[model samples]
Target: MRVILALLLMAGMARAGSDRPGDFDYYVMALSWSPSWCALEGDARGAAQCDPRRGHGFVLHGLWPQHETGWPAWCDSDARAPSRSEIRAMVPIMGSAGLVRYQWEKHGRCSGLAAGAYFDAARRAWTRVRRPAALRQPDRPARLAPAEVERAFLAANPGWTADMVTITCKNGHIQEARICLTKDLAPRPCGADVVRDCRARAARMPPVR
Candidate 1:
């Protein structure tokens, strides 16, 4: 009986964090504000995305695999890593090849896709959402409520509703906009854990370079 109970406990533990590939419920496509990232950590690291010439606005952060109540990360997969050329190709949209590789190892691996297909899916997900053009062209810094950001996104993307998106902040600066999507790339309502919108009355938005 003792041995049987121990085996059962081990089985439950194995299912907890979900390291298996291709075994998740949905995706959260995170779009990071390039300016905010630069202000926060990218500039210090001399990240190429922080270069003024890049003029990046919202860049693809990652497409994360989420369970109904939790998330999976760093899943074990047999897929090969993305090639240098492939990584470089994604830089215009994702800001960094390093980030591309990291996202693949972490979240993309859980998508049950090869590196190329995973990246393609991420690209498709990004293309489906219409980023607010007004926010992209801001010539000066501004403070915006988190709801205002969500409203802008909802206005730009017709099918997206309030529960489908959330705006996150870091260090008083607008951070990332996270949107929930089905495996087929259609917008969906976020899970409870994914709907934690920033409570800040106003968050700083640095202007595009």
Candidate 2:
């Protein structure tokens, strides 16, 4: 009897471990965000892994450019950005049309309206950090460097200039940064060598007037 109980307990644990709740969401989202043939070699491509289970696709490339190193890679994994479409898809449909039925059938009530609402709000809030295509001119890659970009932004925004700049470059691409802004939340470039004043300004933006 003891051995049987132990076997049953072990089996239950294994099932729980292997059955990750969000795997379908990850894969489906990856398809949405990544290029059509992104799985060419089976390695996760670009920033897809950040939303490894499900990606917002190239739509997010401009919003959060991929850095080849550091924790920034997992920024989306924390649920910072979920595509609006992905949010709509998750509650009603999971892996595919087929998954809609499967998720409902299997778990009976795992992730329901609550999870859907949570991810949806996350998607909306992400738009603030999301860089619009108009803002990012990737075609002018040759002429643009992160530092120069910061200066230009400073000029454009007046108060919100680049306060710090940390360039995460690999394969000749500067990935992302930790920007500080003026009291009005005007953006400035900031990084490791950035000054305390910039950090202070960024840290304490004036309330919206």
Candidate 3:
């Protein structure tokens, strides 16, 4: 009986962090710099978003549900996956169908929203934040401090403060601008983990093709 009780307690402990759909405190909208991404990785993958004709700048990365601390992911949900048409429609903003599907499987599932609603919510959140014009179409590569990038975003969007936005870097390139928002999509202060601003003194910002 003691052995059985021990096993049951172990099972309960294992389930403590199990992701449940729609059970998070807020959201984080991640916007990627297209040129920086292409320079670092997308070119190797022959990603269409890297095409010079596309002229993509800041593109939607994902809208992730967050907790005050550690976040949930890959929650099992009865909600159907996005239809092919739905996935394709997001390509202009999200960059690829694979990303659309992958995000749904990972962060989107944890949102507790069905695939369509989740994508729609993501779109709504994306549209709400204005991209900085200076970073949108630079004709030449420039090195900028992460704080400068964050300031550009803060300037473009009123009502957003320093605590609500963060800049992240990868391989010496400015990667993405992440913003914290309430569940309803209003700007909010980021959690401790989400406030990890990139420490790069002058990360490269590749020019838009």
Candidate 4:
């Protein structure tokens, strides 16, 4: 039931240029992963690869690259993480098959995931030529709220555990791009500014022990 979302390129930490509207096919919901879990196949673009590919959690983000055409891309955060219970809540109400169906039914009519755009072999990346109005707005990264991020994190993982979070963005199987988190959000880089923000958030959050 797990499929590696191709849109993950948006989550890449490599360097890339900017993308215009309609440049990409759509934002993607990456398979369960933290920034560090990502992996690169070869030395092609100096990509990083994660070992023991762990994706055992519910979906948490909808990352999109700043650009789709040039080099390393910037990732714009989309949907805040959804609580595991919230997604599963619909299971009984919607049925396992019906849950996914209900999701598509409620959002697919205007969703981008259903658009079926593509990543050409020559371009070696994803591009969007067709899209639904819903995808245009709802899934847009600009709409995400800080509270939503916290709430979603709380839901999916009643006790979400992450010592750190690193971010990365990629172009197909090519280029590597890194997304920079805010001052309040925990970043993955050792000396990266994210460390400061993560420490701050940790200070505010309830003690885990």
Name the top lDDT candidate: 1
Each candidate structure's TM-score, on Cα atoms with residue i matched to residue i, is 0.91, 0.30, 0.90, 0.19
Candidate 4 residue lDDT tens string, 1-209: 13345455534432343332233322322222222223232224332222123211122322332222232232232433334544454333222333333333332322222212211110111111111122222311222222333334334433332323222223221111122222222222222322122212221111101
Ten-residue region with minimum lDDT total, candidate 1:
10-19
Q: What lDDT score belongs to each candidate, Candidate 1 first?
A: 0.91, 0.30, 0.89, 0.26
Candidate 2's C-alpha runs over 4 A off are 1-126, 129-141, 153-161, 164-167, 180-209
lDDT of 3 at 45: 97
Ranking by TM-score: 1, 3, 2, 4
Error of 2 at 8 (Å): 39
Winner by lDDT between candidate 3 and candidate 2: 3
Q: Give candidate 4 misplaced runs (Cα > 4 Å).
A: 1-57, 67-114, 117-197, 201-209
In model 3, the worst 10-residue window by lDDT is: 9-18
State which candidate, 3 or 4, has the greater TM-score. 3
